[model samples]
Target: MLPPGKIPPEKLREIVFNRLGAPGERVIIKSDLGVDATAIDFGSSVLVASTDPITGTEERIGFYAVHINANDVATFGAKPKWFLVSILLPENADEALLAKIMDELHESAKKLGVAIVGGHTEVTPGLHRPIVVGTMLGEVSEEKLVTSNGAKPGDAIILTKWAGLEGTSIIANEREEELVKVFGREFVERAKSFISMISVVEDALTANEAGVDAMHDPTEGGITNGLHEMADSAKLGLKVYAEKIPIREETLKICEFYGLNPLALISSGALIIAAPKENADDIISALEGKGINASVIGEFLEDKDSKVIVENGRERPLERPESDELWKIV
Candidate 1:
């Protein structure tokens, strides 16, 4: 059986990355494990594109499809402009369901000022639920483009929002009955509302404005894994302070109830921004000015092979996250 969540990077390198046809000269950022989007050089500007499939969430799948894919491009300091989506419905799908998805897509695209240029829809032979895969394209001035590989040693590692934001919302919405019994209806409802926080476009844009060396959104494997990806791309080591990482009360209760590691859960809303030590505070202030909470969690190291997570007075090596903690309960 295929593994749940993301395919391991090692396997992806051996089977996918290593086999890709040589890229053209216009290709600025090619396929890489940590790099979020591909960049193509276009004279005065660079076109960035990112694609992701929304199969993990049942509620608001279309909305998630647009925002999630657009987020990748925004992390590169690009303003999303166009979207292409492939909506695949199960054999049992109906007209009403299709309309619902389309409405969501339209609403989300409008909110983000993105145009839905083209897409394909089909009722496939799949025996289960619906899926939406979206491709987001955006442009950025050549001088303003940023990549995950730009993180430098001694740069402060900044993180925005709390851990498990998307996962918490998904669990609350999809598994309301189980959660309500333990956390009560009010708390569960509050957690479910976190779905609206799943987009990191604002955080990314603000960090870009404030000047950042690198930016990465924590998604599948949450912040810890996101940090590892940043290090891998930058060819540097990292030391993350566990205590500095924020976790909401609702996330704590839910993760504890499900026996999941909050840090290892899917966290779409959170962004990991690497900036010079002097600029880190300004970046944090800029994000908070826009109503986003952020903090400096750690700094990059000169040793490219080392990665550590420190808590209290003890420190330990940071292991690569294998799977998202959300899969356990979902």
Candidate 2:
């Protein structure tokens, strides 16, 4: 067998889908393009459930766990109502650290109006610092469910926030000592605030209100990966201008220091909204009115291959979430 990191993308796809199985009875696989979350249909309402572990990074794992799953559910235009969290602290972890994590988790969840329900936890020798996993439960009306596959040929794609926000943040926080010595202390300090912008709760709600056809948060992969997945899910193409892509100052610094493509990293808080051309302005207005920075990145096209138009009038196929550069830095 191949090493864990060297596993083929297709094989990993099989592992995930095989575990997902086929949708039956009360569960509907509903747009399983390795999108953020899964939904279960019960009666007239659809309940979205998504869980993710936060063992891989050090900075604000508790905060990330709360927003990440809720972002998944909110992508469907659903309001997050409940969250179940599991925090497994290492035996030797300090009580202050544990308290800080729990406090951050509760504060964020409460702000989002998501009640902490039920989960399990234990201290074990196998653990390192602490692992926090959260599952968010949200429900949407039957008529308004927007799948990642809902983007149409003529839909305009609007990207919110900067690209590679999460990946850059992780690298900055985790490699602070090295980055400070190499790239100066000011540059290193600037890279860490990317976490403050780590929630799509506003983006999702505003987009839905402004008549967005479909919405997705750019998480595991960056903006390009998200657009590719959306286009493929809808069996369409994306015509985007890479020059217009938003990149944060901190993100640019991190990408430059790490020799990475800013567009191919992780961005948990960014949202991509696909809407009709007429409602594009409305959506942008709604987003900007709420003080959320967004831009008209591109539009969906009829062409089969998803492409991003770049510098000097060149174009290339968009990046999908095959092997993210996030792993390289994080």
Candidate 3:
């Protein structure tokens, strides 16, 4: 069943069309709507817009809110330029909490040289908790516009960073009290630090610089889902090596405890880019130079049928993710 506050990505998309009429002239949706960001054609520059709202884990909400939208724009091969935020707080919300969130947003934006041009805030009964919605604007040259659909046959699949980083971080933060009581404080503390691993600005830029054809950030649906979308959008097939994907010691420990697959969990800070086989080495090295984890997990095949090769040598067809159990565990 769908959660009370959450909507399926498709249903949410239908609502968008229902309001805006047919997306034409003004909109150029290269990939499926509701995936990361939307790329709008603007002649010389492609305008990419992404709006993400922060909910659930409220402690580091502001920090994640900015990066989440920024990452979406980055995946489109754009430099995040502007932000428009919408902040809603409960009437009884503490002033200190609001101040802290604003401060965090400002600092993060400044680091990327992004300006918060305008936004609105309100304290009302309609909101029981704090919610921050960040809408980002970025520009990508038409020549360099990256799409999830840009994957090509024989392109090497490169995944950077540890798996399940975002999911593990959310779980630890949202359930810190219980986690500490059950999983030990050290583990919880380590997991919370995953917050710093939440930037895609470098990952996408470096991959594009290395002449990558496609870029996708694993979010909401995890790496497995991310790979499927990339292949599906490109009308291509992918071969994945389960053993080659990176999984952090902490992320794996928590996944094993919860009986979850790390690769299928949401990982925002990490990005998957399909680079020409010749550029794979330079791409990985560039990302690593910035102290980021990067790896070649597999490659695209001319065969339209996609499959993931397990560590045991078994093969399984890639499936469109029906649901993300990420929220359940975290």
Among the numbered candidates, top TM-score falls to: 1
Q: Tens digits of per-residue lDDT for model 3 on 1-330?
A: 566233555676676536754557757664363356788878878899988888756777778888999998998889999999998888889889889899999999999889999999888687777899999999988878787778899999999887788888987777789778877999899998998888989899878877998898888668887887778667788898888988888788777777777777788888989989999999989988988879899998877675565667878876656655476664
Which residue window of length 10 is worst by lDDT in model 3?
A: 1-10
Better-scoring candidate (TM-score), 1 or 3: 1
RMSD of each: 1.0, 2.5, 2.6
Q: What is the lDDT, from 0 to 100, of the residue 315 in candidate 3?
A: 80
Using lDDT, give the best candidate's number. Answer: 1
Worst 10 residues of 1 by lDDT: 1-10
Off by over 4 Å in 2: 1-9, 19-23, 28-31, 182-186, 306-308
Residue 181, model 3: Cα distance from true site in angstroms:
4.3
List pairs with backbone clashes in candidate 1: none
TM-score to native of every candidate shown = 0.98, 0.90, 0.89
Whole-structure CA lDDT of model 1: 0.92
lDDT per residue, candidate 1, 163-235, as tens digits?
A: 9999999989988998898879999999999988988889999999998999999889898889999999989
State each model's CA lDDT, in order: 0.92, 0.79, 0.82
**TM-score of candidate 1 to 2 decimals:** 0.98
Per-residue lDDT for 327 in model 3? 66
- Tens-place lDDT digits, model 2, residues 1-330: 653122344665677556855556776545366356767888889888787777558568888989888898899888899999888888888878878888888898998999989887667687767889899999988676767677888888898888887887789889999988888888877777778787898899888988977888876557777787777667788888877889987778777877888887888879888999899988988999999988898899888564656565887666564556667766
Task: Say which prediction, candidate 2 or candidate 3, comes out ahead on lDDT.
Answer: 3
